[model samples]
Target: MLTSKQRSILRSMGNELEPILIVGKGGITANTIEQLDQALSARELVKGRVLPHTEWDTRETASELAEATGADVVQVIGRNILFYRPPETGRSPRIDLSGEG
Candidate 1:
């Protein structure tokens, strides 16, 4: 889990990144979760955007995605969500975890 400060730092680092995936009107489907799981494994940190037509609340969507993917929610700003997971190889990762690391 990331502390508030770590989340803040990650949010700032994530600001320059474009959303790699977009959840459309279909919302968070099983396939989406599966894809997100893979994405988190490969990238560690990722950003996603929610389309305007999505009926789910942004916070709810972010939480659901995080839970489904077993990732931490770094931040949810506007329609965008930032997610993070440490690499599985047990190497020291450069992810700014603030004091939480």
Candidate 2:
């Protein structure tokens, strides 16, 4: 679980990141989850969007994506969703958050 401060830090970091994936008419699919997993593994932070025309709700889809990707929700602003996961094994996470105990 992420502390509020950690979520805040990730939000700030997310502000500068362009959405890497866009969920469209298909909603969340196996390919979408695959890309999310790859992105999270490589970058630790990932931002994605649900197109306005999509059938799925942004927040619900965000939750689904996070669970499928094994990532934590950083934030969801508008149609955008931000996800984060710690680096795997020896891979170093690029973003550091304070207030860790």
Candidate 3:
């Protein structure tokens, strides 16, 4: 779970990011979940896009992907969605959600 400030910080970081994942006509799949997991692991903050051909809209796609990846949905605007997940126990979190109340 993320506080509003944390989500806000992530959204700002996401503003400069290009969509790393694309949810196309295939919609959400095992492959999509795998890719999202990898992306979230590599980058604490990840942005994805939902194409017009997809059966799900941005919000649904974001919700599904976030649930699948165990990540927080930072924002969903237009066709783009942002996700955030802290690194695992031993690893340092790439994006520091600390220090900000």
Candidate 4:
């Protein structure tokens, strides 16, 4: 779980990242989850979106994806959602959460 400060830092980091994943008309399919898992594993901070055709709204999509991925929902703005997962054990190049209280 992220505190306000941690979430803020991640949000700013997310500002520069492009939406790596897009939940389209298919909604949250297994493929979507798989791609998201891959992206989050490669990059600790990931951004994604739900297209207008999807049945789920912004929060539901974000929350559902976060639950499935075991990643923290940093923020959801408009259609975009930011997710963060600490790198697995022995992994380097993860988000540095140490400095923020």
lDDT of 2 by residue, 14-82 (tens): 999999988999988899999999999888999999999768899999999988877998898889999
The global C-alpha lDDT for each of the candidates, from Candidate 1 onward, is: 0.83, 0.89, 0.90, 0.89
Off by over 4 Å in 4: none
Provide the RMSD of all predictions against the true structure, rounded to 1 decimal: 2.5, 2.1, 1.7, 1.8
Q: Between candidates 1 and 3, name the one with more favorable TM-score.
A: 3
lDDT of 1: 0.83
Per-residue alpha-carbon lDDT of candidate 3 for residues 1-78, written as tens digits (9 for 90 to 100): 898988888888899999999999889999999999999999989999998865788998899899989999999999
Per lDDT, the best of the predicted structures is: 3
After superposition on all CA atoms, how large is the RMSD of candidate 3? 1.7
TM-score of each: 0.84, 0.93, 0.93, 0.92
Q: What is the lDDT of residue 82 in candidate 2?
A: 95
Residue 44 shift from truth in candidate 3, angstroms: 0.9
Evaluated at residue 80, the lDDT of candidate 4 is: 95
Ranking by lDDT: 3, 2, 4, 1
Query: Which prediction has more favorable lDDT, 1 or 4?
Result: 4
Tens-digit lDDT track of model 1 for 1-101: 77777777788779888888688989888988988888878877899999887687888998999988789988888998899988777667756565545
Residue 33 alpha-carbon offset, candidate 1, angstroms: 0.7
lDDT string for model 4 (17-78, tens) is 99989988878989999998999999999999888866779899989999999999999999
